[model samples]
Target chain A: MQTGFLKSSPKIILRFTDYNSPFLGPSPTVPTATTASPSSSLQQPQTWICFSCSYSNFASTPKCELCGVKRPDALTSSSSTSLSQTQISPTPILGEHSPTASLGEVTSSPTLQPVVTSEGISCPRCTFSNHPSMVWCELCGMELGTFKIDGMELSDDGNVEKTERAQHVKLAFRNGGSASFNNKLKSAMTDREWEKITEPISVNPQTDFDPVRGGISGIMKNVAQNQEEQKETLDQAFKDLDALMAKASDMVKLAQSIKMKLNKDSSESEVSADDDSTFSTYLLELGMSNPVTKKDSGSIYHQELARQLAEFLSALLHKHKGMMVLTDVYCLFNRARGVALISPDDLYKACSLFERLDLPMRLHQLASGLLVVQAADHNDDVIAKRVLEYIRQKGSLTAIELAAIENASIALVSEQLQMTVSKGLICIDETVEGVRFYENIIINYQWDQQALQ
Target chain B: MSAFDFPSIYNFPPFFTQQPNEATWQTQAQLWISIILSYCRFYKIHRLDLSDALTTELFYNKSINRRLKLETLQSIIKMMIKQGLAEWDPPNKKTSAFIYWKKPEEWATSISNWVSENGLNNSIVTLYEIAHGEASEGTEFHEIDQAVLLKALDVLVKKGEAQTLQATNAEEMGVKFFGTG
Candidate 1:
């Protein structure tokens, strides 16, 4: 592992013994003992010279352990300057009777006094040394405590335990030029907005209502007031409208009955007078028409029809036996009830309603795992055709694909697919590749016909 | 081959990880599964001993220098198992699997119908004949794996529509009949 270039260069080695030791400077102008010191001979020099850094240190040292600059020249040099700066400073002497210095005052003073310790932190800006625990520097008046200090030794194992137990302080700002402790920082947070207020609800004897006495008294007073008012205003208007409605309905029935009688009376007339007679009467009374009918009783039949149709279609899509894609159902319902296009919300409500019915319509996924709806009276042939066609063209499809195609991702596609799969409208085809859909749904297919053939 | 030159992208380790995106991962996993299945099928590899050789042919990724390790191979097989594509022969046989690109049930049904259609019902046929003979020519059953065919036959036998016997100690024989049951 030796470098090729280093082998060609000449090597040098030196050994150190004391402060006056020759190894401190290269090409030492001093003599070496060259032999084992005789025990009775003069004791070796008490101090030593560090050969790597030229610094004076304790003698009888076997190696320069701090600089780690090995004495052997064969060792390649480490590029770092750590080996050249090991200096041992002499202990500083305390000056007695110094001006502006009191023994107790200097030790206890706290305001921005930089005290250097082994765990001292150096300010990057001012180079003022301070203990790591100090928040501000004494020399520069600069804040310095928040930084992370490294390479400092702990006095005891208790320091490690103390640091481990210390909690991080969280500071929060408050409005109106003030700040206070927020207890929530120390407690478990709730998964709710802070502004939500809880009010205490209490049962009070003064506020509770009595139903039996209140019901009878309230209805009696209301009935008396209505009776007195009915003689003059609102009730009379309804009474008059009721009489008019009866007359109008009677006229309609009389007209229908007359038309039926005329048709029955005619034995073999070539062209019955029903068409022109009804038309001419309308022409004669066109300007002088006084058609009297009560306008109040509203039309509920059309509304009931739409509601029934929506309910029926929803049931057809969701019932257990039938399975339809919601999109398909939407299209079919809209087409069948021509000119009556249901809104998306109504379509959704209908699906949920029918899902609640017996044998809920199940949503299913295709072989490509696309979403589809299955109604109770499911037309499997239609589903099989559509799903097969999709898978064939796309190679594969996911629920999102089916949803995009259907244009309604939320209501019809997801629920119906889940339902149909649960009900086995489709079989999940898993390959080493991934799950897919397959049309192995065992409905009443005529396998017997093929077998007989 | 001169130590198989690895593509630089193979050094990009993400290529070995199963992607999280559904479609992307599905396609990637499927492609790897298909490639491995086809390689194993062609090589008649029942067990993959990854330590045996650093053969680049098994994983021919030209653009990436990295190749599938044994663990990654097992993961791909596991993905296939999830899709019902292959099954480990046993829990301990993580390195060996019986691939069912068409599952045993599917194969059984297909074979039974093929037999009934060809009027091979109630007739005995040798295992070799069923796999490579003229009768199975141009069909999915042609050159079928013997162990896979045995499992399919075992399914049919349990259903009472087929029975199996050894025509010789070294030979396999099976008979089937289309039954209403």
Candidate 2:
């Protein structure tokens, strides 16, 4: 019986101890069993023994009533020795007697009789007995499997308070089983406290929390810190870019100094003239010191851009033989400007302003609608005379041959040749050998006498 | 005649290709007109077939390997026709044209002069005898194309200086000339 109580006590303790209540009922057998030693119990002062069943009886009874056998002194002596042995182990004694003591108290006391039920679980919240198979109270709807200590007070006061909130139920066993149950329950509570103390220590370091860092506030703080770090990295990248730009400007200045020195020494050196001119042109193309930008020039952007463009292209136009296609100029101008690149529309508008601004380099549109930048000195009349001179010198000249001689593109040369043809200074022969230009002889031919012959 | 002397411009490559500019092309057209008239007169070529002319040395320059395109030659011929220097031979078809180095009026004056000089005024003369007879040999009108001779006679008839006697056969046609009254 003691072994059975020990086995069953733990299950009841585990279930009931979920509620942390200070009012866990005390063990009724603990005080008495501890104080009354086994030697004192061996005296067997007031109780009479039943030999057949080894049952303890009241002092008034002499027979072994459980089996109807007569009580003998030898059997009484042997039973007393066994009782003393059982009393030496206090848990077994408590387990053996506590159930019978609770049962006697249940029968003798009228107060507890209404609270105790014969079958099924009783809800402490309403004292409603639910069916054994039901997990919740049928009347109060309190959970039946677990006891809630909060409901125990209402039951103890015997005052039923009805509220809209769901009520928790406390369990109270009436068969003295609660004494051993409370003992096991107290031991489980201590074990839970031990776990609670060691839980933080066992957590992984990444999640381990100090008093200042634990919940949503901590995560928000970390996000803010990460944003600060990102801003700093972005600022560092911009600083590096600024430093690179400064170094680039310094290099440009050095190249300009070298070009100045080469120009000063150019008259004495013959071999370096070509190299020096090209190098100076390269330096000139590196980047303009102050390129006209929309931000800087604002409303007069195109006008200022036109002036700057004329200044920039004047030298280049001479190098390219006084003409360049508009697209090629756009590329070269943007390359020299470096950072402030202009769109095609902007370049066109700026070139259009060349006539209004009276710049040396004007935008020239060919018969085919192809736009070109030509030096102001390189007009149709001058180009016609140049072509006429070449044709007169060579007797006849194709566009390709002139392009090779002039070191200009065939398209530009051909356009010049056509302009000359339009001016009546030169004529073209389009044959299987391609278009060839010749001096205008028909204009000077004496028609009257020539026709008469 | 001594081999016809070609103008220096004839050897020019651009002369073989038509010009594109308006003023330049007009000048080029005049040059071509003079060249064509002189060339036909030198060769005594009364009619020019455009396709056959394209391959001839008159239109193609073998030394320079440049040939005047057909469309350009046609345009030149059209220009000449506008000036009465040339006429489409079959009239409606443009494939061939008659080049008048000496126009019918000029040929009529030359024939009237020849008749008066021969003292044959008011005398009927067969058109074939004027064109192919030994007496008319070495004359400018001698061996002239029959069609051109008839055109020259028609000019004289319009001037009231000559009258044509038409026969059933075209070869036997005759004309009587009168001294210009």
Candidate 3:
């Protein structure tokens, strides 16, 4: 499309197919559509204006007889090389129209008739209006219809009802200024919008509601609330989906890891495909949607927080070393509870309550006063033996280096080393590089000598 | 000549630092005390100057990349004094210490045996002759400190096994061991 060079001439039908687009820009032109929608000018045929002579020609004629300008070929794809030079975007221009529709001769098949278009597609070069069938402008030889990227220009006539309900959700959220107003707004907007969108929840909630009565807490309460809020946000997305999809990408990582893990152990679980549908839905529910909070837990806040903390940590311990730094625990616990954030003091109190209970995991404070959570069955002596072996090999190394060896945190490793020092398994070395630990060969050798004697 | 023996624990890095824990500190102190005594005995170091040994390889362990901090070194020396393995010279000033790797009685036994073995019993010998004479060659007391030699002679004299010569000059005093004490 040397559209710039053809500026002086009448617009040419570089690709005659632009006029045959079923729907171009904002208009849907199918004559057989359910309604006699007059939205598209292409649906009706009319006179074709001569682009060069400024002479009006009959719709039946493909060219200007007086100017001897031959009719341009019906629209076809533009040569891709010069697409950017064409003033009208190429993909939106050609749309779905076919070349046969621009042929002047009548076809025997009922569906082959040229789509009668009154609304002339403006020439990219000459500013002249051309009939849908004209492959090239009568005046300029610039290509008429080159743009045709499918799916980008689909008509949304079918989704009108769905989109309207999504709008009502937006209105309600905007009107919610106060907390009570917001709550009411949430309930009011719940029906129709989300109900229509998520006819796909398909799977029932798998968690047993009764067996776990650490009391339902606020997690369940947030679920009903989430349905309303989630739909409202999605309704806002109906207005623009591109941004929403970008934001949703982060939510894909956890699902991918879970999917990878499931694929690795697929035979071990034998879970049905239906279970997987809810699994993705559960991923969307992440700690964000179902957090336990003071508003819901009330009198049993600390107690419930403690139990939830224990349950979460116990599961984590299976993956991590049997311990987590107190600071890390605070962050993860709060994240698992979502909007229900707890204060550090509150976390400490919640942890203290564990001492009074018979839980398997307890908060441990090291000799240096560094705090961590460790399982009751977890043994430091085992780590000590490993530390002893490690020190003997490296001769001596720092806690940070040992952390790398054991795949644990520096804080945890440092505390473990201190305990080993107390046990006389290894001894600490304070050097310029930092503190390192070495095998307590003195004690062992002394004992060995005594045994020999 | 006997080989100088060093305990294997000297190569350990932490062996240089005094432990922070009470029980560990006590054990490390005892280890250091033994190491110091053995090292002195091997080198035949009669007196240890705290100022000089502070920067020596005897205190700073390069293999372990650690050094005995001044505080830890002083503490170990004090523990040595408490155990009678060492005593501070000019007791109040405490600038240097006399390491008693061998007790006075033990030295007296060796000196008495050396005199009898060399047939020098009942024959008076000047202090210098006893300290540096050919008869003293290959003996542990060959190069014994004068103060330590005098102490050993005092032990023999106290037992009535040797007589101290009444010399006009104190420096020329000699001793006669009756027989192998």
Candidate 4:
């Protein structure tokens, strides 16, 4: 029953039965109780079949079985009847109820398998791919000492070496140094808890630990000192500001007092004093009279001051002819006092008196005109004739020009002109430019004209 | 000699002071009013500048050292305008004033009457000959400022007393007195 010198094994016997049961081929022999089939041995080598459903399979499979499909007779035959006849010359056959051929996809090429890495895996922490024998994450200084591969540490010596103090210090420095280490130590042991606990036992020739607690205490002392200094500086600044404000307020009050004094006195008298005081004190740093301390000693001084002021004012109006700036008069008033006697209010009163007495004052008129104080009411005909002759000679005379000629004020010239006019000897012509007195009686004197006729 | 009578004691200095007092000033103004006008007419002063030298002698009289300022002169002139004794000439500040001791119309009437009385009415007269020439001899029209004579002539022309014609010289104009009465 052997074919081509290949012996049929027991395992090949099932494949032979599976190939014959389906639509792959008509059996040259059928499985029967009556006879042991010799051709069945030869047919096992030729037929490839489905292991699951007894269908014909391909020859390339290592073992004959239903791979993925479960149906009987689901394997494909290449459709070569001649090769089938050669392999199974005396073929065993299955009955007419055998299953159909398979419709599954097939290809000749095989799929590749996955390869395992040779070196150690990259660390999830620092991503440094180190040797599997190493017990720590090298780049990030992570302790991988506890790793158990098949219930044993990867390197016993490597784990032991890491526990040494020098190695720990090296790693600590690399991981943000002694400062970070101290912080971590402090966080782990709070101040209260550390106080309750025993101090660390001092070891000789220690590099990492500063055996005394001085470093931390020194840092805390420096921070406290800095905070104290800042507080002192801020307090000093506030003190300076308060002093400046006090000075400003004092100045304001003084100004108000002076103003009140001016209101009570005359505004005119204050004007001159104000100018002189400012000039004298321009570069001075002190004694700017504070308003709070000015003493107003009632109205007695005011009366005395007013009388003197009136006299002074009356004199000035008689003396000066040009427009007098109020400030000049104030300076004179302030100076004449043996002491700082007149208040701003009194100063103001003096000016008002001057202004009020400008008109209706007989003294003012005499000062202004041809009538000398020596002869206020008298018309000095000598002066009148002189003026008349001068005008007669000059044809026109201004107030000043005439005053100069007659050796008198405009007041006197004005007086003489008025007297002359009243006597019907002259007439005045006034215009926006100036006044001119004409000889009316002299022109219309009629004696010569009457004689001519 | 009556003008020599002194009215009161002359010791008051303010009497020499220019009266800022309006009533006193007004009285003062009125007094100077007549004096200035009369003096102007007496001197034939149709124009007055009121210079310092003139004011010195006229108002002060040199008996005292005090005098009126240029400002006082201006104030007096302003006062004079109120009384209608003076009119300001718009073109000249110093020269503007005209004293109307007699109005322009009256001067014109006086001239016409004089011409008629002299039997010279209806005569064609050269303006220069009438004002400055022999025809004006011993008359008020003699040697008048040209402006004043023209103003008088214009008044006469308006009154139908005269007519004017341009003359050969620029300033020599002619006047013809037309009225017989």
lDDT for each of the candidates?
Answer: 0.45, 0.69, 0.62, 0.46
Task: Pick the lDDT winner.
Answer: 2
Please report the candidate that would top TM-score against the real structure. 2
When 1 and 2 are scored with lDDT, the better candidate is 2
If scored against the real structure, what TM-score would every candidate get? 0.26, 0.59, 0.52, 0.30
Could you give candidate 3's per-residue lDDT for residues A39-68 as a string of tens digits?
222332234445566555543345776685
DockQ of each: 0.01, 0.40, 0.20, 0.02
RMSD of 3: 22.9
* lDDT value for model 3: 0.62
Docking verdict class for candidate 1: incorrect
Model 4, range B65-131, lDDT digits (tens) per residue? Answer: 4454566666677777776666676535753466665567767877788788878877777767767
Clashes counted in candidate 3 amount to 25
How displaced is residue B31 in candidate 2, in Å?
2.3
Q: Compared with the true structure, what per-residue lDDT tens digits does model 4 show for residues A248-304?
A: 656645655665565555454665776545543331212223221125435444444
**Decreasing DockQ order of the candidates:** 2, 3, 4, 1
Candidate 4: DockQ?
Answer: 0.02
TM-score of chain A taken by itself, candidate 3: 0.38
Error of 4 at A279 (Å): 43
lDDT, ranked from best to worst: 2, 3, 4, 1
